[model samples]
Target: MITISNLKKIYNNVLVVNVPQLEIAKGESVGLVGNNGAGKTTLFRMILDLIRPESGEVISNGEAVAGHENWKNYTASYLDEGFLIDYLTPEEYFYFIGGLHQQTQAHVDDFLSTLTDFFNGEILKKGKYIRDLSKGNQSKVGIASCLLQKPELLMLDEPFANIDPSTQIRLKNMLKSMNKQHGVTTLISSHDLSHITDVCDRILLMEKGRIIKDIATSSSTLAELEDYFAVGQSATLLPQIDEEENH
Candidate 1:
């Protein structure tokens, strides 16, 4: 559903993202894993057109994302708390987003009703603005808002960083269901290896603004990722490990 070509983003002459080509098919769940400064978020921003790429273009459904509005209709993303309107209450923000999608208040309410366990009874009717909530709660609000849009393509950045363990499990289940049953294409970047492996069918390992490894999730994928991260500069060792595992 998305295609990128010759993508490059630089800051002050330092290349931050240098993806030459990448493609995501419809209904695929892809996970991005990397340490700090891997340019995952920069790649996401370029895909969302929130920032213009220095060299290339992001294509969504055959149209350039850089100067197009059509993709916004089916794409929903929550990168951080910055995506939320801090001054607005969670309910108000959700309703506003619902209105933008032409969903009635009743529809939104029904949709939120399914998230009672996911919210853990802390999100709705809290009577506090989004900013007043703790970071975890704020993350919940942002994620809920994205689900409210019923997007075809969903992108989330570090969704497990905040939130309690219970909520993380719930979110993972929700993502899996969205992809398996509802066919929502998902792109999630997370530092949590176990969670990402459980939720995504494919994993992209990025380093130094480049995609160093793109592996289809397998029984040994988690161990491979762990080894790669454990031995920071030994990325060249992954292929040997993979071959050994296969044999």
Candidate 2:
């Protein structure tokens, strides 16, 4: 449902994102793994039109992102806490997002109800503005609102961050159900390899603004992925440090 061609973004003479091509078909869940400055968020922002790419284009279902009037209808994205309206209550936030897609409050409520297991009762009943809630609760509201629209393409960055471990498992199950039940195309990015391995069908690794690895979960084990991902490469080198100290 999404395609990117020759996408490039540069800042201060440094290239941040430079994908030559990418395509995500319907009902596929892809995980993006990368270091802090690996340009995952930059790529996502360009796709969402939050930032204009210096060159190339983002297309969804044959429609260019820059001029697609129906883009919002097909795509729902949450990149950071800033996307949530600080003043809006959880109920108001869900309604607002659902209304953007021409959905009614009932639609939003129904969606939220299905996710009660994921929410753990912290979503709509909180007595204060979203900003007043804890970070984890705020994340629940943001993710719940994103799912309320039943979007075809859902782009979530660091969805597992700040969420508790138990709720993280709930979210993983929720995402799996969403893909299997609704055939939603999802693109998620995170530093947590475990979350990506458990939830995503395919994992794409990025380094220095380029895709370094893209592997299907069925084809590889997490330990092999850890070797590929170099999750604790620096830590593993500590033995070498010990040798040097002895020398």
Candidate 3:
């Protein structure tokens, strides 16, 4: 389980996050949706212990995540290109990450075999360094690498952003299976309300660094979120619909 209490982050006198309390039970899939600067990435960083909060604590599996190393054994995340080793080829990078998780070469190979369809034959043995791959392919590599660890907790920020539609569907299916079969807990932050609603069992809406709405996914969830964004045009909602209509 994940727990946050009195979490707060400040930057140059501006508050980035302020959540009095929150909890995500084991094996739950949660999606975070918000406009830019809504503090989604900052909050993910805090959860990963990549950044320190001004005050509050994050507990993972009964351990304080802020100053603990045990959580690393069961947690995996892919936030952005910054998380990858650009100099290494995809295979090399995967092996390195696998080793870190105590996975052997055979274990890594078995994991990568399952992702061939997701990679679409464009990633493996391409003889291209990670930096040389297109943004979408790079995203595929990063995501696949994260799963190679077989982590109990998986966190991804915008896993659907740059990938093509086919791969997006593949990833969504993969994540769903992981959650249902392996019982992996997942936290995903995305701008696509449709995709998030499709994959997540629960959704969170954030604005101004605060969670304003939390709802379990249902038939009405997507429409409700769309309505919220439509009426909130001036709120800087993502891919904001323009006034011009296509005829």
Residue-by-residue lDDT tens digits, candidate 3, 60-121: 99999977999999999999999999999999999999888788989999989988899999
Q: How far is each candidate from the true structure, as Cα RMSD in Å? A: 3.0, 6.4, 6.4
Candidate No. with top lDDT = 1
lDDT of each: 0.94, 0.84, 0.91
Which whole-number lDDT from 0 to 100 does residue 63 have in model 3? Answer: 97
What lDDT does candidate 3 reach at residue 82?
97
Candidate 1, residues 172-227, lDDT tens digits: the string is 99999999999999999999999999999999989989887788999989988888
Model 1 lDDT at residue 188: 99
**Candidate 2, residue 93: CA error in Å?**
1.1
- Candidate 3, residue 88: Cα displacement in angstroms equals 0.3
**Candidate 2 Cα outliers beyond 4 Å, as residue runs:** 229-247
Off by over 4 Å in 3: 233-247
TM-score for candidate 1: 0.95
